[model samples]
Target chain A: MSAPPNRPVFAGLTSAYPRSEELVRATRDLDRGRAGAGAVETLYAASEKEVAALEERLFTTITGGYLRWNDLFRPIAESWTGFSVGPLTRWLETNTFFRQPVLAQPPVRVPGTVAARLPPVLGQRPEKARVLLPGPYTLARVLDNRTGESDGAVVARLGALYAEELAELRALGFGTFQFTDPYLVREPPDGVLETATLDAYRTIDAARGSSTTIVWTYGADPTPALRTLDRLPASVIGIDLTEVEAASLPAGPEGVGLGLGIIDPRTTLPENPVETVKVVREAVRRRRPSSVWLGPAASLDLLPTKPAEQKLLRLADILQALRREGVA
Target chain B: MTDALFPTQEIGSLAKPSLEELRAWQEKVPFVDRLGPSGPDLLRGDAPEALPDLRAAFAIAFLESAGLDRVYDGEARRIEMYEHPIRQMAGFQFLGHVRSWDSKYYRKATVVEPVRLVRPYHLDEFDFVRDHARRGVKLPITGPYTLADWSFNEYYLARQPGWRGRPQRWAAQREFVVDLARQALRPTLKALVDRGCRTIQIDEPAAGTHPDEAALVVEGFNEATAGIDAEFSMHICYSRYEALLPALLEAKACRQWAWEFANRDSGDHDPYAVLRTLREYGDTRSIGLGVVDVHRDPVERPEQVADRIRRAASYLGDPTRIWTNPDCGLRTRRLDVAYDKLRAVVAGSRLARAEFASSRR
Candidate 1:
């Protein structure tokens, strides 16, 4: 039986964007004591505006570009209780590194930490904004868990903290939240991860009132956790098409949306829009998702400014081709 | 092996030279002007010929003054470990900077064609160090596996277009790494050995990046140092050392394993837990035991360093099998910090030696 065709929406970057040359210079200057805090802020604001304008042109959902964030966990690590920034650790197989969060005690969310870190432009169009966060599973896996809690318990606690943050963000008019879980696919799926993942998402789902919740997994193959992932409480389940073929994507739960990671963000080579649309069509046909979001397979921070921008433009081109073909 | 118990050596790299320091060395070293313009700044693309040699002289003097048993030029002649070697090789073009961690960026390159060594990248630097240094020298070269892992492989991926999966990528990576070992690193190692450089440390921080491909590390090492007659050691830092144990044990050419344990475990609680694990896996190779943390600013007391050596000694069952050093390259630390850390290592080794003598009595 042929699966029904579904129209897909464009979701811009679900993680940090590569810093522009000017922003990079400003950051270095700030680090070297040549530039003041205000000067750096000015540059960040300008970059944030440019990013917002670019996303407004191409995306159905927009982000603040995460220009100020050093890494995915930096903001939380700096502001949250019981966590401190530790030594540099490799982020999966990539050359990039993140300061691992050292948890001394149970994690507790500090009020307004997320909002303060976010670009002010996000507040103006909260209805269209999407906030990217590190998923509980990934956090529990990456952090130096010194709280003496089991991995499962740590995941649950982090999920509860995120749940509170989500409730607050939802009240602030944010429309979508993407929780990236690279660790889920990197490590083998066990009973502990499966149970903890479900429980954590359940907590996040309960707190997120009317806002879209997405659980996006990348960096490694997500095939092993497909069964557990299909049953996630999130509104959308994202899979890296670069890692798994489009045809191999199993059917998702009824009424669940799908985030199709069709573009490869790690490489500088430009992807063909026609070929990308074909992959999206195949994934939609197999998964039979209620809705879809087209995006990069992972974070765009690994690439340079020119290549990252080109990747986004390619995504815009793919969307246009999809529209012409009556797929979206 | 040195006659001294708990012989100390530098891991690699001292702090980078300041502009004033470079100028001072240029004035002092008479041959600096005759060396001609070389060593292109990877980021800016300007050749500063005399600067590198002068920098090497400056670093060698520092290490010798610190009283280390084995010392190199502190990698002062190069831009960094990755870019310096890649810039000297063929078929690579530098892309923009990529962040390694907070506020730190390394110039990354892509393999556009089959890579080959243009010349022995470290020979000039080694020659300068040999002329200037009073202490025994161990030249640290970036290993073939690390070079392959750090680079983006455009050439090999293009070779097999049909095999499109993780397995295919892995296959391409293996081919790229092996080719590097044979084509690039082997010739380089041979030239260094021919130059009367006895001890060569192959720095492979990326050795444990892929646990499944641990065999590739062994294969690369063996291929690079295949016919070269020299004492070879493998230096791997800030990695999953346990994952590479089986392959590490198989790497017969690597007589010593210079690994970083101080940064993670300082012998405070679970004293040298990873060392215990390595020994349990039947590892019998000499260890370059890291006693001081390079990332931290506070200097470790000599007694604290002795305690770390003592704990590692307990696991190895032989003090002679242990060599004292800082966790990794002191390039990350300040100049004063690196100097103090090195002094601590030297002092700590001496303390450990005295304690061992007393126990025997």
Candidate 2:
């Protein structure tokens, strides 16, 4: 069977050299002990400006690399330790400087807020590409919930919000969306979580025309969720070629597209072209996936700056080789 | 903080309870309850009525003679860590299902409504120990980052800028955590401080997982200990400490940082070069060096515990600042084994302390 049409391999990039401009400015102001509202505003303004510039720079790729929009929103959350979702919501609604989308859902809804942020950020890039997300399974693994909500309830709501956001993204000219689920590798996901997640994806997939490839990334064995994968209406399912242990290859669908995450984003280990070929061969032998594409398992945020760029170049090399082998 | 840290001791974890003694203790101890699948009953906190009997147990057992300085109420009353107080608090939903964060092999923590400590669960545990132990008692509670790391992420998942829904809920939840820290942790710690809980060792196995979020974890701890004047401590073990070391040293909230030194993987030695690297952070805090390995089959002797403590002490550059301890908490151990190990800890401390004092002279 012929492989499904694959999206271009997008690699992460670094710009403005060793120093992040926002960090430098924040550090400088912080060093001067400027702890006033002006300092805070200046720092945030610089971050907003840098983020916009980053989106432009990523698309431009001065280094001749494909762009991966990784952790742009996450860093905003990370920098402010005091930033809880509650204050963030209040901040977005109260501030006039924060522009609400003209052709967007109301900001009161979680998905709408995600929708409002997407067009500006995703729209900035002219490239037809897939977007990355920490999926419901993974997102549930990383938060503190003192709000008396069950983890299931929390993840279900998030999945619903994500489905809405994914639907909104499809409307905003994004064709291929990759949902990054790292936590799935932690044994088989619970049956209930798996069901909710599959349902969420089906909702998003049906809305987005069944063409978007939702890729699960990071170190995980997908054998347990293979049934869920078969039923979910996505066009392609990305597998981490490196971490999808050969023993874990489950007997599943032949038509499902696969995003083979072969590159190591977190380490400086040079990608051996020979070893990679062997992995790709194994993936073909077992899953016989519609398409087996190679990329990083997770975001470059987990890596130090130097290793990230090196890994990106390795990805570029692998992409060229995979095309030559007629694997795409 | 005092110059002295964790004194070397026998690992007081699983004491082999003969069938007869087990039955006798069960009948005698009012709260002889078993928790989880593993059968070590939580003993001291809520169960034992008074300090005198606990002291008598220590005296009869010669726990002090064994060289153990810090004592626990055998986790006597606690059903599980973090859940006991959360169950007591208002606005908590006990989901009734116990789920492991990763897999069952690593460790298991219950999922609950985001926890804020309104009252200290370990209070009764500490009070019983304080009333009885001739030496200082170590207070154990689940650390803040562990609380944050182990909870559900619905409140923290990726947010869209205009989407304010999850963020609003997250704010409320975080408020509960911070408020819990303020109301429950602060007062409990202060009460322990007042009750002469000289060495307050907060147990935070969760901190190691999200070491990248060290600053936030440290901030939470600092907030918890804002106006307290006790030798604050933190114990984490059996996992990667590399991510947490930098943030912990940077935070400097705890006057002492204790961790497991020996394990099957670590080969009965200092796991990482933590003692040597700890000096890089400078010498403000004491090190509760785990000389006794709790996970190992054959119980370690006082001399073996002493040797490890000596090595850690040398690495720490201050013998006085080194405290000896088990690699982890003894919640997994049987009562007989637990008492035996604790006795070894006390003995080991005497050996190491004598060695250090003689060397100084």
Best model per TM-score: 1
Q: List the residue pairs that clash in candidate 1.
A: none
User: What's the C-alpha lDDT at position B260 in model 2?
Assistant: 72
Candidate 2 lDDT for residue A18? 21
Q: Which ten residues in a row have the lowest lDDT in candidate 1 chain A?
A: A1-10
Candidate 2 C-alpha lDDT tens digits along A70-155 = 23234212222322321100000000011111111111234344434332434555244345555655555444344355556655
Candidate 2 per-residue C-alpha lDDT over B1-361 given as tens digits, one digit per residue, 9 for 90 to 100: 2245445432222233333454455554422322222223333343433333333343323444444655555444554565655554544443222212100111112223344445545665566666555565666676655554444323222222222222333453355446556766777778777766666677666565434456656766877788888767777664456656677775455877777765522332245466677787665576777766564445778888777777776677777777677777664555556557766777777777777777779
TM-score for chain A as predicted in candidate 2: 0.67
Q: The CA-based lDDT of model 2 is what?
A: 0.51
What is the lDDT of every predicted structure here? Answer: 0.79, 0.51
Off by over 4 Å in 1: A1-7, A245-249, A272-275, A326-328, B19-50, B162-164, B266-271
Classified by CAPRI criteria, candidate 1 counts as acceptable
After the best TM-score superposition of candidate 1, give how far the Cα of residue B197 lies from its true spot, in angstroms: 1.6
C-alpha lDDT (0 to 100) for residue B224 of candidate 2: 79
Interface RMSD of each: 2.7, 21.6
Candidate 1's residue-wise lDDT over B263-335, tens digit each? 7662223437678777788777889988888888988889988988998888777787999998889998877
